[model samples]
Target: MKKENIKKVVLAYSGGLDTSIIIPWLKENYNNCEVVAVSGDVGQGTELDGLEEKAKATGASKLYVLDLKKDFVENYIFPTLKFGAKYEDYLLGTSFARPCIAKALADIAIKEGADAICHGCTGKGNDQVRFELTLKALCPDMAIIAPWREWDIKSRDEEIDYAEAHHIPLKINRETNYSKDKNLWHLSHEGLDLESPANEPQYNHPGFLELGVSPEQAPDTPTYVTIHFEKGVPTAVDGKEMGAVELVEYLNKLGGENGIGLLDIVENRLVGMKSRGVYETPGGAILYKAINVLETITLDKESAHLKEQLAQKYADIVYNGQWFTPLREALDAFANSLAKTVTGDVKLKLYKGNMINAGVTSPFTLYDEQTASFGEDEDYNQADAAGFINLFGLSIKERAKLSKSWPKIED
Candidate 1:
């Protein structure tokens, strides 16, 4: 990578410490290659305000704030949710959003005719792998530059000092020490005391939460709500149709009030180290629960079982940053097939941080009242179980008899 030939470079800027410092660092190291800052608005509310102006102040030639919220929720979040994929029992909300953001950044780099695309992701985290992998999959010809891997600055303290010395305006306070990532789906908090798994997370620690009330602070009264779905995508709340963004926002308000979604886990990063993170996903949790409730009625037994197994694998694949692989696409096809019939209404009871299924109804429901009832008439016979059980257990019964005859003394 020759500095003299490099005319322009695109940077994945978050308006944070690392990225703010990287703009100047790129100029200092790359002989002042024109830096274009690209920020993706996946759902980080007001954090993006004045980003373009701020980028200019930081010595960027221009700034692109791409609004990918609709695409993010529709294309990435919903598809993963339809698979019921949860990485280690916590939804891969963050993992699912990364690739799409990277894609947006790469797309900007190509359209702007930048010579290279750079990212401020740390060396030890998963985002670097996710970002670089997207470039490899989508725009392989583009030069990839990762500042964390190449920069001389080694610590957050050093980066913060650089930002201060260079007059880069990043919001930092003594009260706010945790690193946070926020989008429309959820918010994730890591670093500081969270680096140690033994420490019980301090809610009093600033910036440790988003979108939900603490479980302890949740009201004792239960909140009941109905969520309607069409082809596995949530369409309404309480019988009113809404857009993807509105539906999620509605659910977030309801779920947060009742303390619905919060997760703390020590998860494996793509770089091969375990990191502790706390996530707040109030709306996503409600939607996942409501969708599963609908699927219970809609999906056939075999399809439901298979999809459950596939969900875990899907979660693993996404968590490992394999979003662009063929296997994930194939799995997505299967999930879509199963999701086609997942249309219905689900009523959930939210109380004390729990999402409880209250009622479910779907047009494609496979549940048969006659077969499942205790007072079933012609649909079933009591005598049929005798033969069926005997036939099914024949091999097991023979094996047990042989085992009895060949039994050895146990200690």
Candidate 2:
């Protein structure tokens, strides 16, 4: 907590407006401590371009750019997907990536033997809690410094002015000042006109949309995609086998072309405030839908329904930054057990933001079409339903008889 205690600080740098200023701020506030900048690559693509030069130019002693895309999808995104975790209508694209990025930062900090870890998350945002909670869980001895909470600058305008005065090069300006977070899972947009719920999101705004086109701008024809899943994990797209990262990237391109994922919502933040955000999650949407189709065939009545209820708890845990908790691990264990039978292929049609199920097939399906058919079948007898109806409705019949015997009262 004291400035003199921090001899070296590893900062989570994104080369964004806030993080670009954090390097110099850490140097000034920590009594000119050595700053090591770390940028986690969770599929941000060109957003990370020029980050090494930028970090060094902004007063960082050294920089480490970690490629965490494969780890992110396999460990975080896929597990959450198996549990069907969705925070309201959100697919939890941004919520799940924070802990992953923070974990990478913590690992680098330990490797670099840094005394403290720093981030640019503001006090009002949920990311501060997510990043710090992860650090606390992983490396309790490491100190955390959040400059947005300690710094004198209050607003984006003030931060920009400070950046200008300090000669910190920034890619964002006033006109394109929407706060954004991007990873392999999704791209979230906030601030600027998005702060007002009444204003429709500028989906077509320059630099606002990187993943997909708007539904209105999508092609007139529908795009069909076939996905194969093994143990609830997506394995291939259109019969082409790929790794976790490769499959998601492939779907992102296909789904983006069809405008399959776009969400606008005013969600409750972990910081006890409601915030509006627009999100684009082209590939993630396809995965969620496809996996659900496989689940319908594999999971039976009781286990499937119970998992659905537990999924809400799972979503809450991930959204509230409780990824490292025991409950989450236990839940994942249960989900993994249930996913053993969820191996199949699902076909879907994507058209102008709508994902319609074409067909789903699995080896473990409970459906028996022959017995379920209306025509005569060797497996089922019509007389069996009469006995079943009598037994199943016995309690209801008794209740009705008792009600008939009771005296009627005037209202």
Candidate 3:
């Protein structure tokens, strides 16, 4: 709740080039504020292995590496998945993770008695908005320090050079050039060749497709997977119940083998510019298909139609980092209420990069075989249709007759 005198600052550290430079940058700018590096473990794997010691070596007063994989899957990913959210056909893999990570940073800031929270997100990226909005939502009093907007560095290369000049350790590897953000649900790749929409993504190596294989390299045989839902949340896969984290992991493996859930889109950033991004969201895509199938079987016609409309808006709200706003909360409530009847089991066949619906069943299904049957039946609804049609078309017929009586216009 203080002005500019920030005694301490907690940064959302990722042990990347940008964050490695940010520790020194924050210290240089903030009048000797203690830098507390906090790394969130959302399934970044070995990238986080040496992060704690690396943070200390990078001049962090303290390093806090919180393992949030469970929370990320259970609280953040699942809730968003309930609505089958996708931002322009790209599973909101990176969008939903930012708020939870930002929340973690803000929580640490509160606990550390830090006046400010720092993030390495650039001014031009969606993450800056995502991180700041979350900080505002959770800890409105906390000050924010965004180095990309303030620092003299012009590009990622310049930041890397700064890190090199400052003797910061480098953990460069084959997956180096392209900027990537990975988590349990999905992995997103941007920058470099991905920046150009015309450039066909070169999926040549192991880490090229972060989650799994490209469609071209996938196995020839199809893989079938069944997903069960209770009140719109994925409960099990192939009749086997598993925890949230494990469920996503399992789905990812199956979907990846089938070469499913790969997307390339040139999206309009929250900032002014447009950027092309390639996303691998195997698990998310499968879950979305399964849930949509379930909804079709269980939800009534009007609710299903309304949900389709709301789902897009919900994706936009989350994609635009408006998760904490009142409108988002109201929309979430509306989504949750609609999801109540969306309980069922969806059988899907995954073959050579395609997920085809096998079947779906639910107790609340509105599909009635007897009433819908064309053959002879005791329901006897065919004769009643003549009278119903007469009344239903009366207004239109009357209006047409009146139009004929009016003076004809010259064509």
Candidate 4:
């Protein structure tokens, strides 16, 4: 849509550097149009402080801070967990949060009678696709604006310069401007030294690893805890029931303290480029593993195998920003069905970035002690294995017989 047609625009604002500068950039470029800023809060603590006053001071007419943390965990995180989805061990932290944030932007746009929904996602990243696709899905005719693709400002330094000229108060400067995304599930760090694949992460750098310490700096003693799950969703820790937000927060603290979930990888982005990023997903790491440990005895061989295959596909769907599509809904349904049997308790020992399975128990466990016992029993028939082996190996035996005439065994 043309700039003249956009009398009002709703921006998917996060009080971050990219978005903080974007509020001013949109006004200067869009005929000084009415900018309504929507900050979808999914538990990025302290980031939302003084957001409304800041938004207005920066050129936004109004600000809407949507509290989606509980919704994000219950609706997005747990479903992905039940599906056992992981984008190359990433835990779908930033991947899944985009849709949640975009949905809020779309809703606020419609409510405010806005002509366009703008976002601060860059042209080079996956979030641009995630946010735009979701906004388009939810609001088909609403115009979408991505300032990074349209703006003349080429770099973060330029953005800071622009912000300073406009007198926009910012929490960061050019030196500390690492492109980051934080939410209830994880905190992702990109750019800066993390842009290089060969560089080792400064896990011990002060204030670098915001969530917690490195494994080397973690406490020596192990922390053991049992997580209770109902229908594949984590409900409690150490037998104490908690709400979705509380559960994740509690686990995040524990997992962070133990240096449990720090991932450094050069992942294949949806934009057909490899981007190196460091992720801190303390609680999410524990949740994913806990479900895997529970599913060990709860799910049967066929279901488990099929779910694993589907999980790979699901991970791709999420990573590619297809969250609101029918395919995602279908996969979620399949995951929900399989997860029905995934209710159980998983006991794990956390120590220095290691999660060791201590114990697992479920009422629906398929494991039978009697059937798996090594001792001889009156009901067991050892001689029956000969016929079973013959039937099972029939195809291999016939293939060998057919190939015998083709080549000598010695050759």
Which candidate wins on lDDT? Answer: 2
* Top TM-score model: 4
The TM-score obtained by model 4 is 0.97
What is candidate 4's lDDT per residue for 1-411, written digit by digit as tens?
Answer: 888889999988888888889888888889999999899999899989999999998899988889999889998888999999998888999988999888888888888999999888889999899998998799999988888898898888898888889888889977878888889889999998888898998999898888878999999999998999999989989989999999999999999999999999999999999999999999889988899999989999999999999899999999999999999999888888888878889999999999999999998999888767888766668899999999999999999889978866683
Cα lDDT of all candidates, in order?
0.86, 0.92, 0.84, 0.90
| TM-score, candidate number 1 | 0.95
- After TM-score superposition, the amount by which residue 269's alpha carbon in candidate 1 deviates from its true location, in angstroms, is 1.7
TM-score of 2: 0.96
lDDT per residue (tens digit) for residues 1-411 in model 1 = 566777899998888777888999999989889999999988888889888888998899999889888899888898898899998877887787789988997888889988999998888888888788878898898888888898788878777878878888778753465788888888888887788999887754433556878777789889999999999989899989999988888898888878788888998776778889988899999999889889888988899998999899999888877898999999999998888899989999999789998999888888988888888579788999999999999999999888987868799
User: Sort by lDDT, best first: what order?
Assistant: 2, 4, 1, 3
Q: Where is the poorest 10-residue window by lDDT in model 2?
A: 201-210
Write the residue-wise lDDT of candidate 3 on 111-204 in tens digits: 8898899998988899999999999899998889888988799977777788888999877633377888888888888887777788898875
Off by over 4 Å in 3: 1-4, 173-176, 405-411
TM-score of each: 0.95, 0.96, 0.94, 0.97
